[model samples]
Target: MNRKGYYSIQMQAVCDNTRKIRDLYVGYPGAVHDSRVFRNLPLCNSLEDKCGRYYLLGDSGYPLKTKLLTPFKDSRQLNYNIKLAKSRYVIEHYFGILKQKFRQLFHIKLRNITFIIHFIRAACVLHNAAIDDEFQLNENIDMVNEVLPPEQDLDFVDEEEDRDARRVRDDIVNDLRM
Candidate 1:
């Protein structure tokens, strides 16, 4: 969906601590921003615990929500923000493994977005299955890193600024101080 002749689809994924993808959403046009894709997804309703005790850690591209924690914009390297950012590595690692195992995702040349989405979904499922089979990817880690582009700073939009979400973030910051 790029204006310059490139067409592809985006994937939004959630990985557990086990490095296995727990939830995957695909089919958003490549031109669409990641935050929009995440907003439209029903992950909040489906993943929120009854006790409201669980939360998912997301990177800068995701909006802060009660159920999803994001680091402060232009963070000052506070301990709380440092910890959250450090913990977010798991999901990034999952993506790296998926793209490494399914080279198609590395440069999705398929014109049909639907097909690209299906391919990505299948890759995610296979990635998880491989984990279950005790697959070791340590050897491929360096090779994958070599081909991948350096991480870019994403421009995030605060689509829905909820006071409650801010409160939750503040509470976390305060707790870290204690």
Candidate 2:
């Protein structure tokens, strides 16, 4: 059981600006923090081993890393942060679609974690299939456009320790300012 007093499963997905899921990770319990799920995945290592300038925009719940950009928390940097937040909305939209389309995700009550994982993964697959088939979300559900921030403890990073990551973030911030 999670902190929510019930069994819960979480999914970490990578979505494109087109609001279509590109990749996903599943099977973590609801109590597991998003950053923890990310750290446990091979995805971070794979990206670190790559040579490109690719990066994923994550919300504040995620730790800032060279491969993952997160919004600036300072109120003074609100404008700059909006750029990252706006780009990150695609994943939120994808989640909104997934929850609305597969209502099971909204209120899952399965006792088996394995079943819950498969169920959520299947829903994601079907979601992608529909997108590939040119399906659009119903207007009624489309009205739910806002991203709901998850209730998880934010992971803190030492700016001095993650110097490289900070530099990369600053560079992106500068570029976005142009």
Candidate 2: stretches off by over 4 Å? 2-5, 48-51, 138-161
Best by TM-score: 2
True-structure RMSD, every candidate: 5.0, 3.5
TM-score of 2: 0.81
Residue pairs with backbone atoms closer than 3 Å in model 2 (clashes): none
**172, model 2: CA deviation in Å?**
1.3
TM-score of each: 0.78, 0.81
- Local accuracy of candidate 2 as per-residue lDDT tens digits, 121-161: 89988988898998866653233233434344546555763
Every candidate's lDDT: 0.70, 0.74
- Residue by residue across 1-178, what tens digits does model 1's lDDT show? 4567676567788788788987778887766877777778878555565225878887666677877877776545356666886677777777777776888777777767677777778787888888899987764222112112223235543545556777888888888888
TM-score for candidate 1, residues paired by index: 0.78
